[model samples]
Target chain A: MAVLTDEQTMLRDMAREWAGNESPVGAWRKVRDAGEAAGFDAAAFGTMAEMGWTGIIIPEAQGGSDFGWLSLGLVIEELGKTMTASPLAASAAAASAILLGGSDEQKMAYLPRIASGELVATLAVDEGPRHDPANTAASVSDGKLSGTKAFVAEGDSAGLFVVAATDGLYLVEAGEGVSVSRRHAVDFRSHAEIVFDGARAAKLAEGGTGLLDAVLDRAAVLASAEMLGMAGQSFDTTLAYLKQRVQFGQVLATFQALQHRMATLFSEIELMRSAVEAGLTAIDRGGDTRAAASLAKAKANEVGHLMSRELIQLHGGIGMTDEYDAGFYLKRMRVLEQMWGNAAYHRERFARLSGF
Target chain B: MATLADPVAETAVDAFRDEVRAFLAANFPPSLKGKDNAMSAVEGPTAETPEQAAWRKAMGAKGWGVPTWPSAYGGGGLSREQAKILAEEMARAGAWNPIGGMGVMMFGPTLLEYGSEEQKLEHIPAIARGEVRWCQGYSEPNAGSDLANLQCFAEDRGDHYVVNGQKTWTSGGQWADKCFCLVRTDKNQKQGGITFLLIDMDSPGVEVKPIRMISGMSPFCETFFTDVKVPKTNRVGEEGQGWTIGKRLLQHERTNLSGGGSAFRMAGPSLADMAKHYAGVDGEGRIADAELRARIAKWEMDWRVFQLTALRVLAESKAVGGVSEVSSILKTVGTKLGQERAELIIEIRGMQGLGWEGEGYGEDELHSVRAWLFGKATTIYGGSTEVQNNVIAKRILGMLDHQ
Candidate 1:
């Protein structure tokens, strides 16, 4: 297991306090209104970097923590609870993949920059709105690349892009070979569609199917961990609302029907929590992670999606309105549900990896 | 908990296994394999014979009545792991428990935990020798689910308490020699004034009326206790401690009833075995129906998960001992899987499964149908599915119903 030591716990606690104190409830609304290209606080990012939070997943040789995936997952979970939009998860997860499968030269070239937050990168692997990496329509040739990558996360802002081509993985500059077009996701996050036409690129690794699969598994697990944080936030928000929202001469929490629903939802989240921990620990322990990652992602997709839907329904008409923050969680969950893979994809993958 | 097998303890376990296996080989008649009906040795149709009684007496005299209890208390005194190994070896040897009436399954563990020294000395020996049978009297007609509201009253009469109410759902009461019951000794408190009392089944004014179930067999009965005098010394724990004792006793009862042994020792052809037997080998030696095969594959995956979970709990309990609520979760998931597996087993049988009679269909097929019918009780008994879910809510999630 990648141990989250006392120091990591303190870092998370500080972030949680900031989320409660500094971050306003309508922070995202401010971003939407101001039309500032999506961003987080520079001072807070500096504080995190000084505390070495930015290097929480990087190797020691690259001047980072190297505590591994579980610790990084915890950071993501805490950050997600605040709905703080940042490139931490994307950068760390993508950087970990580079460390795992990229050659020594690749690591020496990019790891330090990513660790210092000087450059942010994200994995662009969704081929045609589906989660199948093998169905890549993008191809590479002679250090030049030509293909379009759909659903590029934070594409408008990211400095570097890790693109999966038919041959293997290729690294391309954000604007040189790639033309970024913004699209409004359900969560209202900055997503993009990128078209690459015979643009200059560098191939990172070739014939690294096994290594790439392992990295993809780690990415899948980290994505689930982030979703778990969203689910927790949704559950707590809905529960607090139920306790305060009075109806029929008593609080809505008093209704057995609602209590039962919340109880079932709580059980689902707890099970998902354990599943996520198990998956992360499997990667850290160097055990069979193919099955564990699929189980975690499947559980997160199913339970996270369910919790989002329930949170909205429980809040009644106020939940459907854009003015309410519950709608944001619901939207975020929808985006996360389709991020790495949805429930059905993970279930089928779990069965296949388990030798079923 | 990491448990490297102890070489010394492993030797002891293996020796005990060999002894039990040899005895079973000599004693268990060979005609009972794969017979689900024969699994319940207590309910078998074979008449009691002198040889069978002699064999039982011989086995009982060795203090192996339950094999897991302490020798000082008339038990086998083996370690918990050894006891489990003994049970497994005996099951593998095809020899049913020679002494597994209500006494061993329900009362033995409770008596070990809560019974007084004198009570243990007097009762454990006779119980170990299979000389006495015990039946539970906790569930009353008016208190099935809301058990704490039982109205069975016991009036103090100087030295003895006169129990004057009734208990329903007393399993195996018709064959039991004694009944352990709960009665209210004080009326002022809701659940605080109860007392746990043991009384002879043949006492005056005692009546047992069997309640027939859907299976056509009366596994339980309604036991009436009108003016039945139980000695004050026979009361377990304190006068007001009955509720606590009863709850703890029920935990053990549920755990033992739904433990891991049954999951591993399910009868007749397994679902996979049957699918293979009936469907025959495909072009690549696979099952024919892809959907059915996929469902079975999922079930198998879940089954392995449950087994690993069960083993984890078991190892934890062995290392640091206590009655864990984790058992309730196992019971909930395990019983659901068991019921689903039974349904799948029947579906795999197909046309020949329709034959309930006739010698054409093998004995295993008939047993499979009976097992399918019998498996329905796995969820209903040992606290119903609804009860289990509530336990999961209250105990695990800490989510009590809002007042």
Candidate 2:
């Protein structure tokens, strides 16, 4: 973990407490069981707003704490542990996009509402299932945008979309030409495939050529933070299980084989955390973060997948059952792995960024 | 646009910086710049060039070589921040600390913590000044990972103990002036029976034979003791407290082996760059072999993640005591990465990597092959990977012990 300031420590502790009390995995289970198209509970996000989590990254003038990306990452990591189903990550990414490129008018119109949790916004980059931002087919013409964005998280809930076009980024409200249809992913989160037949496009032209990539990089770090949480909780669950569950008249943790496996997972998870925190730090530093973002998400995907798999296998038969929460973590892990970029995607991207 | 010194000008830091500069300018010979004696790490006091000898002597006298140790014991007694400044300045000047060995790295710190006032008065000054060399007398043939199972007996004879036992893999044993030994004080109990004893290496019946390793280097020795007399006054702690003190010392050793800030770490082009030199590049400026390219990329990413974790650990541990649990994790990860890096280097070399002899092989190529072989001992030595996992599990993770 980073050497967090007193403020960051308090914020992280507050988020952990709130997530544990208000929205645990059971809360996500309820949302998933209810089959809501919006994915997360509205009341949960309202509570988030009340606690000022929805505004950590937004500037003070825009009704937020402006604590920065590391602060936001710390909050999101806590949310991730409890499997808190919210558009917090998505909305934050969208907020970052606007903050980076949106005009003062856009900031006044959207930042406060987003901070208050009254409005949810999301970044739509890939037009296909995979997260390929550079291969965008969406185009803007005469203040109108037309194209498709596949598997957009929080799409059903987002009132605004920071759409990535072939040229750059443009903001489009979720109405009229913007049609959101259900895209059922394995995690059962709110995902949508939206077809925009010339939606009213407001260009984020001030962000210049690299705006879309910058926005996606921020989103990747956000996703990595969540994965860090899930991976950590998975390890904690397994560690607790190993201590209690006995076989052959000895606790499972006593076995050298199991102990070594747990140790390996523990170290790998630490690396994953380091990568995520470094990425968040890089984003906060406001320097070139392309390589950092790729490495972060790549490690999250790599370790998250391994850890989720190990979480199940370590728990034995009970882990395979639906009643157990291990499978939920694996499900979420698979989805998040594919979110910003999978291991291979980011590895390739990292190689390109590193010029290897 | 500003120099690194701009922010701290005219402060106490600047004064100290000036003092350091003055000290270096007067004492540090320009001819010795950028050249660290490679043998310093693996061997003891080989015949040094006049400049090297002068450099070591000057550093020892000034005590800046062991900068963070107490000044009462002839050390610089600098704060952590000051030590960091000294490191930066030294690196900026292409200077490396010439005063280091097991005495400075592990034993000196442990002795300061656990040794008596008289013992500290007697021993620490020499260690701080890099005047005497020390070797560990802990591991034995019967006790590798199960170090407590050691059976080197130290029979009590009122004023002194007659030590009659052997300690293997005693690193730099032949070169050391003294040995910090773990001797069995009681034959009845395992851990409770151990005693920490200091023995003069030149004493009668003390023998050290350097063992040739697969790396073709004789860096370690098979140390034997045959009725070697060690005085009761030389005992570090209580008779039965060796296990506690020895374990604390191992923590220090493990931290050093963890490779966080060890000097003499490889420096040059990265493995990817080296691979490009060996294997041709494609049209897109990528490694020619896609599979090899991906593997190199993966290694770089993993290595990066490890380095970041090291940084985080350093930051989190500020204003705190020793990060004991973290050291095990560092040792396990760092050693594996070291081994992995050697393999990647070999992979980059292809058939050229296997060169071991005089003709046709570059000095670097031959050295790397030996380093690759020597790297295997790293994981096995400073608490093997399996033992480290046990440390993580039982100690750090609070898992149940074997009943």
Candidate 3:
């Protein structure tokens, strides 16, 4: 097992309890059945805020605990075990960008509300079909921003938008010239395509050039942590099914073929866990965050997808139906697999960072 | 990247690291730099040239050869962290650890745990000083995976035991000075009937024949003992208790085979460096071949992940005083990755990878082929991959027994 500090262990246990009791796979199923437009339970998000998770990475002066990225990642991982859909990941990412590049006045005005869950924010960086941080076509000219951003997670619910433009990162109010139309995502999460038609915006002090890359790398690490949680869940659930399900006059897990496959997946998941932990440690310790983040994300993307696919295959035909919880994990894994950057994208980025 | 939480210990370790770095810089032979010493080969101390002998003697005298062992036993008596620092410093200087063999990897550790005081005094110091070579005598013709099925027998004859058996795959048997053997003492019982004995390889009636491998090197041998006489005092533990001792020793062997103690070393140039030299870079400073670049990137990422996991497992074991069954996990994955790396090197070299000899191929290119061939045994030696899976399934996952 990976070593964890006392505080981290406490946070993990608390998050696990919350996910098991307050929000679980059944909760997501209920939300899906109710046809919720926000794609997640708002009341649960409020409960999370009350638990001080939304402020986990924010500064103490900003009404946060200042626990740092690793703590936040622990919480996210726990929630991911049940595929809990919330704005925590996106909002935390948006908060990180502000903390990294936001001016003091900007931080003072927005961070408190964000930490309190009174305002919802998310990064809108992707402007095209691909997951390219540098592919932004959005432009900021004379205090105004105009362009369309696709796959803006939690865009429909956000009150603040951290818009990435060619010039830099600009803060835009989610009112007036901002029109957010909810986009149907394969994962059934609340994602939107936002069109900014000359919206008045505030440019961060160090917003342009490399700011988006920095924020993306941080977000990628957090996202990989979530993927790790999901992959673990899928693996455990499959193993349970394998043990209980009997076929051909014996339990499925008794077969050497399935056991070998499960063992292989187990090893891959363990590897991913280490990579994700190292990434968070890198961010906390000021290491080569870009390369570490990319490494984690790439491994997580590959392993998460593989485990989910194996979960379905190993579970047999029942896994294909919406009635089984396995389908939800598969769907959620697909979205997370492509979020921030997919395996191929990060692999290329890792190569470039490594000077290949 | 995080600063050590314990500043005093950190400073001490830092000072130790500098001392080690300086010593290695002064003493490590420049001629031995970049030389492939066949560290994985289990063969006995081959007749070393004068330089190799001097280097080994220097390291042995400094007691840094086996840094973690007790100083009372001729070792450096360093902490695990200090040992890690020493290894890192040695790697940074492109110098290999001068002391390696079954003694350092398995026999010494086992003896430290199970051997009597007299035995420890006699053997551990010699091993620590790099003066003795040891070979394992666990498997026989009938007991490769079912190791307890071994038929080698030792009869108790008052003050001594007369042993007779054939042990196959006795690595370095042809040149080893000593053998840590497992022999049957009571044929009526299964695993309980075995005994662990330490015998001199030069004992009368002991014979060794090297077995050639596909790579054209014989790191292993077949040993036949015809009524070999061994003193009863040579036994490490009580008779009929070798099973437990043998299993424990294998844990150490598996850990060593998994590269747990050594710094990650590449047998040839790094994948990226090889790619750049063989496949020129594109205008964007990327490998010109897109597919090859992606493959190399994925392989490097996998290797990094494995390395990080190894470190995490080590740190966890150190903090909490127990080793996880993840050693099996490490062995399986580590060996597979090593093989994949070799395969990729061959792939990147194309036709140059196929050369067996001649000036057309660089030394690294030739080494790449041999390394690839030798790597196939890694998954098979310590424990076959299938056997590891069975262990993981039963021990870690709690899977049911099918048979």
Candidate 4:
């Protein structure tokens, strides 16, 4: 119910300007054609970082802007509009988890670098096929980490890693024992299979009292925010395409059928936005972040997946083709579909949280 | 997402709730107890006796016929939140609405917004007391979807307007005491040059013929107006501005129509309840097939979204001064949800859903099937979901006309 204020407006506008200038559809096409990932643009990430986006939600003490979650939600949404392949979303979310759950020294050590865009971080939570942090196959053994983490976004590119082990969070830097193998994913994001073969890791937060649970909860909220942005972009892009793409005696936009479809999709986007906002509000008000995060992630996963599929299906064959930018949004949507767990995972999480 | 934990409006709302509860408890007839009037698919006011009349008179005297409108205009003059409390209280008491039909649902609000002072004074009191029932005069043989292309003509005369038109799908037109109508005042213009006029049902050369449906219930009618005279004063708004007025009224109509199925709660066994009731013992307690249950779940989810979207609309209307373009989106989504939910209920009923003769199945399940079949109107009426998306695209999304 609290609408975006001035600071939120400014952050959103900045992201919009940056996206329009640096990660335009043409720029995305250029990157894609040059064999770069759809959302894996380092130059664009640098620009976003320069615009003070990476640290928008980080504290001022961490050499970052102290904007709220709503501001960060806006920035993520704008970046999602272009499906710009940058670890900006992952880095911000991972950094938020650390800043919120990490100790004071942990925050001081990692946050400043994250804020300055000197190091990028991605959470390696899914050690197995299932995206469950609690059911971790990857364990910490005597100050060393083993087992593999799949679908780690920017894992190959990231300099710092926030690994959620059985014990707690371990700060695993890019080193000899840690090998990052790039995983060719559907969304064309720079995903990786990070293998830790007895990798020496530093435990940032030990004596875990649901620290991994807390971090995963935060990750869900953060991923939901990013997905909120993705769905918004998908809705906008599809709407624009519907208007411009002419077919059979009238513009495809003229079809009432498609209009109705777009309207339904728009409603889904708003629902996702509301859920994400609710999670942010809960986090802001010091409410139960776990429940809110589950709700947000569940709502986002449902709407995000449905909207993305419909966005493509409604556009017909043209929506399926790679010539148009619709595919980019869909790609980002697929990546988000798996990021921080899918809809089913969140539904079960929500069920558990709600004591269903 | 603003915490309503200690919402500022709570005190007044709580007081209003108490007042409504006390009033309903005292006045609610024993005959109406456990009635669950809202659950009825074919909505007819349930209170039929003099006691019921007295109750209606008492509530209507306080302008509670429609609670949210201004008291001067024969409404309760309550804030929306207060009105919502009254509704919740009434709903809890199993009380039926004192008034019904197109007048209360669509026309009353329209008149309040666009009616002249004379029109308000003439119409509002009668409407509040349920003294006059109103019907819509918009759709024609060829003008169901493209309503603006209506051929209904009203020629200006010295002292009045002479209307000559045919309106079809006029629900409850056979029973209406009056009709608020749209007439093509100028043939030269398509959507423009139209006027909204009110005419007495008993006016000379006016006729209403009920159109019998497959359900054997004639909820709608075909009205033929041949030189039916309407007073100049009966016009709701300025000349050539009726199109705009009609459009706004339709927005209100969509709001009313979009909320159509929200009140549907069957007295005996909802589809889900019946599924639970008739399950396991029959075959592992799964009242319906897995596919059917899945479909039901999907529909239930759709219904939840529809309700949430409706609540969002109401919340926005309260937050902003007026309705947003998202109302159209709600209308579109809610109607589909209703249709889908009803269809699933019918599908879940299996062969019992097939009703041909009198009371073959239980009243609830049979009524559900009938309701499902009748729910086809969801897509067709108030403004097809098609037209709604056009509004969303052009007005809300700013995509259609951007080029």
How far is each candidate from the true structure, as Cα RMSD in Å? 4.9, 2.7, 3.2, 5.1
lDDT of 3 by residue, B247-351 (tens): 999988988888564326554568888887788888977788989989999999998898898888888887787885555688888888889988888888889
- Model 2, position A224: C-alpha lDDT score: 95
How many clashing pairs per prediction, in order? 0, 0, 1, 7
Prediction 3 TM-score vs. true:
0.93
Q: lDDT tens string, model 2, A55-167?
A: 99999999999999999999999999989989999999999899989899999999999998889999888888777877888999999999999999899989999998888
- What is candidate 4's lDDT per residue for A246-301, written digit by digit as tens? 87767777676676677768767765665677777666665467766766787788
lDDT of each: 0.74, 0.88, 0.87, 0.73
lDDT of 2 by residue, B1-403 (tens): 2245677543767878888888888878777887676665574557778788788888988889889989988888988777878888887787878888899989999999999989998998898777898999999999999999999999999999999999999888888999999999999999999999999999999999999889888889999999898889999999999999999998788778775763135465688788888887999888888888898889888888888888777777763545624545777887887888898888888888999797988888888888899889988997899988988888878887878
lDDT of 4: 0.73
Better of 1 and 2 by TM-score: 2
Interface Cα RMSD, each model: 4.7, 1.2, 1.2, 4.8
**DockQ numbers for every candidate?**
0.19, 0.74, 0.68, 0.23
lDDT of 3 by residue, A199-256 (tens): 9999887654667778898889989988999999999999999999988889988899
Compute the lDDT of residue B186 as modeled in candidate 4.
94
- Poorly placed runs, candidate 1 (over 4 Å): A1-50, A200-208, A354-356, B1-71, B76-105, B126-132, B257-331, B348-368, B389-403
When sorted by DockQ, best at the front, the candidate numbers are 2, 3, 4, 1
